[model samples]
Target: MVAVALAGGLFTAASGCAAEPPSPRERLIQDLKTEPQFKDYSDKQVECLADAYIKYAKPEAIELIMQGKTPADSGWKDGVDGRTLTRDLAACNGPIAPSPTG
Candidate 1:
């Protein structure tokens, strides 16, 4: 039984280590530098930012995101959408890879 428990713990640790952590907006910006296609912009990005805004920010804040503005500099008055935006951002974690530059 102890061996089985140890194996399980090891497996859990391995899985956790193998999984890559999600990127932050700042990281995304850096990625955009190399993969400029990501910089091209998209309606989906706006929609995601809007969803994120609605969760962590106000309607106007969400509007800013929908307009392609980053939520970090939108002058939010009510504070963060917190866990809500965090969850939405997770859900919005689809591919944002830029297309070929040339």
Candidate 2:
């Protein structure tokens, strides 16, 4: 009986220790929130920017940004077409979309 109770406790503890990692979108939002340039942005603005980035930016660009590279970086810029990305993200300009100007 005591062994059973101990095993149950251990199982419960182990289960609680496992936590799901944040999704890519969530990570983008967190990255934006931490950026000095976005310091003044509201949560809603951050979410909108993250959504726009995911939808319009190239996968490589998104990956680079998530890895802490600025859009101005040569590798990051190579992955993004500024005009097209900016145009596609225009509707999300409620708080000014992220610029490839970096």
Candidate 3:
């Protein structure tokens, strides 16, 4: 019975270790998934968008997000030249389909 109790205690201790929290980039991807602008995008597309933000957006933009700020609140657009970010994000967005309203 003592051996069984010891085994149970070991199991409890092993399971008590918590998993590491998500990284900043992972948090950014999760945040992007909830954005209305990305509503039509697939998970892969959202990940791509996050990658673009990491690569093209200013370092401060990502840092702000890591500090619990939303991308818009972080002034993501103003962080870097819009044109460059636009060009990089365009690749992630792929070919745009014509709007059904049109």
Candidate 4:
């Protein structure tokens, strides 16, 4: 689950980095910057994507969303990886949110 992967990544980063690790929101922004689907995105697209992502987030991830963090949640399975997130987002219709790419 996301909790497990987050825990793992958090620990690894904490152990390896002398500086602060990127916060969830920062990570989200960084990831968004690299997303191919988001490349042509203007400001509207950024907001739209963020808004759309919020609508699709897992129930547990809603809080992080409210806090403007990444859509990572404890309820999500780590089996859902980054590639899956993009595919899922692209495939999504209505309000179905993509899972975290752990």
lDDT of each: 0.55, 0.75, 0.78, 0.57
Comparing 3 and 4 on lDDT, the stronger one:
3
List, residue by residue over 6-39, the lDDT tens digit for candidate 4: 9999999889978778664455555565767667
The local lDDT score (0 to 100) that residue 12 gets in candidate 1 is: 91
Ranking by TM-score: 3, 2, 4, 1
For residues 1-102, what per-residue lDDT tens digits would candidate 3 score against the true structure?
999999999999999999999886798898888778889997878888888877766667777765766665645645577788788788778744556877
**Clash-forming residue pairs, model 3:** none
Worst 10 residues of 1 by lDDT: 24-33
Q: Give the Å shift of residue 99 in candidate 1.
A: 17
lDDT of 1 at 86: 65
Flag clash pairs in model 2: none
Tens-place lDDT digits, model 2, residues 1-102: 999999999999998896899888998999988999888877877888888777666667787877877665443234567777776566454545466776
RMSD of each: 13.3, 7.4, 5.8, 18.0
Question: Higher-lDDT candidate among 1 and 3?
Answer: 3
Query: What is the clash count of model 4?
Result: 1
Residue ranges of candidate 3 with Cα displaced over 4 Å: 63-85, 95-102
lDDT tens digits by residue: candidate 1, 1-102 = 999999999999988886556444433344433444445546466456544544465556444544667666655546555676566676655545554762
**In terms of TM-score, which candidate is strongest?**
3
- Count of clashes in candidate 2: 0
